[model samples]
Target: MAMTQTQRFGIFAALALVMAATRIHHSTLHHFDALPDASWGVFFLAGFWLRGAARWAFPLLMAEAVLIDYVVITHLGIDFWSHYCVSAGYWFLIPSYGALWLGGSWLAKHQVGLRLSTLALAVVALLVSESLCYLISNGSFYWISANVPAPRSFAAWFENLGDWYLPFLQTTALYVGLGAVLHVLAVQVARLAQHRGQTQH
Candidate 1:
């Protein structure tokens, strides 16, 4: 059965807020940390969790992200945008995130699940989706608007991909996989309780 809108929003809204808090406290440095930003995972889950009008959750979460950045830059006196928002490439996030949403949506459309085959298919879809998102996002920034040195080459861009893309995939997988596990556990617990109550009757 299709998921209800409230259930979808409840899951995503809580996750989005938590991730936004981490993003808020995040520094400009590139060092990895225990609470690496969860936007990538959050959006991936959004596509998985939301369908129909509930898909509106994407833009809502996007807005929350923007608001987080706004508070960080304006209220907190951080120049986050200046560092990355130097060109038209920044706006490509719409399509980048769209690809993420599409990835999860495609998984649901095909009835992918927790099993090995479905999980494998999901990984492939996620890889393709995130790869495309990375290309558009990093590619636009590097080739279009970024202040890359004159005479940029594929070698240099590949280095950037190394810095950003793999970490993104890893961070997203870590969190989303954990969430999937918890979800399965909760379903099992609920089912077990139901069985116990029925036996008692």
Candidate 2:
């Protein structure tokens, strides 16, 4: 039988919870080190599975991020609400994700795609998302903190962009690759489970 939306949602929700728990545990044990970009699997699945509702996908992902950020920030003595508000800018990453997925889908449908091409696209998409995130974060910090230096003009914005751009690119690419591998493994596991269930029946 085909899965119902509610069933699918429940499955995704459970997966998200598991991912979140694992992230917290690992972060704690290893001094807040990111285990993997498991959350990107959530984004990729949203694109491939629920492409039509991509906007909603971002909000949901951001909500999870907000929850996680809140815990981390509070533990570090930062104000929860302010951090949540700042983190809201992460929603911008969705458009970058959509662009990548859509481009890849289009290429695949045309049967003119290479595995490396899609992987490169994923990396570029992550970089774009990270750049956008840097802008969002810098702006938020400027807005919230009076002591923070203002990017008052185009040059300042450019400078700010340069400052975080490389780090963002590196980390985003790393996470995107990690996320892609996780997504592939997940698809394999799901297919295997389905096959086993069919055999049992």
Candidate 3:
């Protein structure tokens, strides 16, 4: 069944909000929060669900993220993005996040797969999108950083790449994958209900 735009946004936005709540308590990479963030999933789902309006999806999602992080810091007492380093290269998130939406939109445009085949396509898209996001977000921030010491070695600064990147991938994959499963289940249930109603008539 075809989903209305409102419903599509509702499902993805709800998931992003709920899953991100877990991260808000201690969401930063340094915090070691085990719960996966729905951030990537939000953009991915936006690309898949937003249909033709993907141009505005990144900004919208970015706004939502900023608002959530502010609330997390002020209300929940978390330290994510606490320093001024964020402002130096933060706008790069526009492209980084847009990569995610672009990936998912590509999948939808290709019509990827309705069966389990979507898993492969989704993973490929996920990897490309997240990898770029990580590079842009981290690289730009680190290089432009006013907090880190001067004359830092690339090896020293980039040493934490694996530590941060791996978990980020894990979290993003966990939420996006689970969200996809839930979406499929929802469609199945709806079809079943419609089938039942038809039989009753």
Top candidate on lDDT is 1
**Model 2: number of clashes?**
0
lDDT of 1 by residue, 1-201 (tens): 345667776877787887686777653333468778777677776777674534467788778876776676667565656665546676787788788778877876775455788778778878888888888888887888756666888999898888887787887788678767876786677779889999999
Clashing pairs in 1: none
TM-score for all predictions? 0.84, 0.54, 0.80
Q: Which stretches of model 2 miss by more than 4 angstroms?
A: 1-50, 53-56, 75-78, 81-114, 143-147, 150-153, 184-201
Q: Is candidate 1 or candidate 2 better by TM-score?
A: 1
Candidate 2 residue pairs that clash:
none
Give per-residue CA lDDT, model 3, range 153-199, as digits (tens): 78965785766898777877777777677767887899899999999
For each candidate, the alpha-carbon lDDT, in order, equals 0.73, 0.52, 0.71
- N/CA/C clash count, model 3: 0
Off by over 4 Å in 1: 27-30, 76-81, 193-201
lDDT of 3 at 121: 78
Give the candidate number with the greatest TM-score.
1
